[model samples]
Target chain A: MPTLRRDFESRDDLIAHYREQFPEAAAVSDWVSDTRGGRDAAEALLDNVDPVEYGRTRNHLSGAVTRLSPYLRHGVLGLAETRDAALAKVDDPSRAYKLVNELAWRDYYRRVLAEIGDAVWDDREPYKTGLDAEDYADDMPDDVTNAETGNDFVDGSVRELYETGYLHNQQRMKLAAYVVHWRRVRWQAGAAWFLSHLLDGDVASNNLSWQWVASTFSHQPYIFNQENLRQWMGGRFTGDSVGGGSPFRGEYDEIKARIFPRA
Target chain B: MNENARDKAVIWVHDEMLSLSWLGYVRRAAERTEIVGAVFVFDDTWVADERLSLKRLVFMAECLEQMPGVEVRRGDVVQEVSAFAEAHGTTRIVSLASTSPRLRRQGEQLGVDWVCEPPFVELPARIDLKRFSRYWGKAKSRVFRTTEEIMEQA
Candidate 1:
């Protein structure tokens, strides 16, 4: 019933303000764990740190892109203002360039929706239309709905989305790919559910991103197996080795049948 | 048809969930012109959502009951308004611009005069540091990888 505040000054101040404003929101901002060593430990490992040179780390990259999507979607934040702020903080053009590229991707998807006008749904190259809607019904499929996908990585990401209206950029893309390319569900179906649930869900970004993953609009389609899914979605859920147990163990034939059944 | 008639019948056509400010439009319009009929359009898809709570419907029903000479129509807002206009012989159609583009376009296409009302709740636009921080944090955190962890650590 309550709405999130619609304005903010700088990044650091906003984080602190959100923590102070909402008690439950404390966990919302925590991307990586202070404790490390375990796969679940969210320690963002920096490949190298050079303020002068600017470095890339897996943690930094995923964390940065995912965090802003929610705010920008809600109209609480503007892309231009954020970009200007970054430029003000650091003089390094390379660092600013990398960050700006991420923002451009967000804008790119918006422009795609504005220009294409929902033609993305009409294409239906790989996915069987109306199949996912039938399988998932009003919600997601039982395997996903029942949380018995046996894939810890899949389950963990789903849990993260349910708990916080957030997911890392890489994880979200992988999830969409798994659903569309591997699971063979319609991208819009998945996108619709995301829009209803995700607090930060933006129509342009969510719909186009799902299309991009489904390979409906994209030139290249991608299928994420257990290994790729495991790596991106923190680690597996069962505390066993990555891809251990039946977590990511559904047969391809079975998946194909369930997702893209014999026409 | 005299342009300046003392007793003019005005009809308000709009979507569901009437805001407080929207209600104000009804009050003011009613004062100026005789509010003969008010039609609230229940679009097909919105009805299907099933997620729209009972409270909202009750609130709308209550609002409709309060207005004088207000006629509440259930499906296809534009159609309802057009039919009501013809039946009641409404001289000039009065509508709030908060309605959807489809409805707005349909209204325009039907050759009805429209009046766009500005936002009712004009909260002062003071530079809110707290608000700025929240959105700013969200924006920075997107690419500010350490932004979350660094803040969490702090």
Candidate 2:
């Protein structure tokens, strides 16, 4: 066991230290996130939380997201503390309802994690897509991993996840669907990739959420049409066919029919 | 409570309890004793086995750097923590409670004292976790209320 040096001249210095210390991870990707981790950064984000706006606009990519998950995921801020902070932001408690309810999701997942332990990596239930576990690809496709998918929405999402180590919840779900449903890859592959990169990645939240999109832990598989992606993206990415090669161009029913042909 | 009791106690700072506020919580099941220092171990197993990316490591290191006076170590969590405690001339290792089984297992091996943070909401000893809606059905009523309000109601 070796003690790590804490003093740093700058963020670049700190990143270099990590690159040297964990060469394998650096070899995986030398990316660094702009999201600094600390209580000061956490509280600053907390102070700007608009519960009303969050409720109205959270589904959108550019919405009032609170960007507090990295702090929350690391236990830099406890669930109760964050809930109280959100409540204190609003005059009425109900205005904080959506934010608090979402906190309950983390709490719920944690409880599930405690109960199930390492089984978080296992499929909790059978896929609802009428596809067996063996039917899906075990490894993620290199194009999706390398951000060469040629589809704007999926490729953009892959780039975002890799570069920023963060993804909006909508993109997370849509990307999970793109992998599990459209690509016929296993949810575990997507979950593992996400866990490796996401700053806020928790085994329970990441894996179970993957299962939800994969329909292994939900009543139905989660899928969204191009219109849904476009609407929530706030026009950041087209979610359109870049060169007429996107599999996401259809309606919800059409997508379901195409991806889950057996179901 | 004599402060000397904590001259031997050290808080094991995990990723789950990075808040300075959490440092104030003395582990449950321990007598009121001051903690002399804190140590944060980057679990070698997680780093190597999980293949955690540089971005993840960098973000975590940034968080650790922000916390003043936390000794950082990278190795097997249980071994590193045990060695840290021994180097400080103590067997007592206190930490904020975490639901992470990996941490829990290491804590058991080291006999780390765990300080339980306040629950986000109170629930039955047994409740459904099969689905969010089902869990929320029970959680929503209490969730809107503060932990204090719920305790008062109870």
Give one clash count per candidate, in the order shown: 14, 0
Query: Tens digit of lDDT per residue, candidate 1, span B1-154?
Result: 6654325555554532232344455548556676565555544344333222222232233333333334555555556666666666665566654223344466676565565442211122332222223323444444443233333444
lDDT of 1 by residue, A80-112 (tens): 434545555565645665655556566455434
Weakest ten-residue segment in model 2 chain A by summed lDDT: A237-246
lDDT tens digits, residues A1-263, model 2?
28998999998999999899999898777788888888888889988999889998999988999899999999888888788777877888999888898889899999999899999889899999988999999999999999887888888888888788999999999999989999999999999989988999889889989998998889999988877778899888777656665688777888888888898
Please give the DockQ score of every candidate, comma-separated. 0.03, 0.76
The candidate that wins on lDDT is: 2
For candidate 1, what is the interface RMSD? Answer: 17.3
Would candidate 1 be rated incorrect, acceptable, medium or high by CAPRI criteria? incorrect
Query: What's the chain B TM-score of candidate 2?
Result: 0.86
Q: Could you tell me every candidate's TM-score relative to the true structure? A: 0.48, 0.95
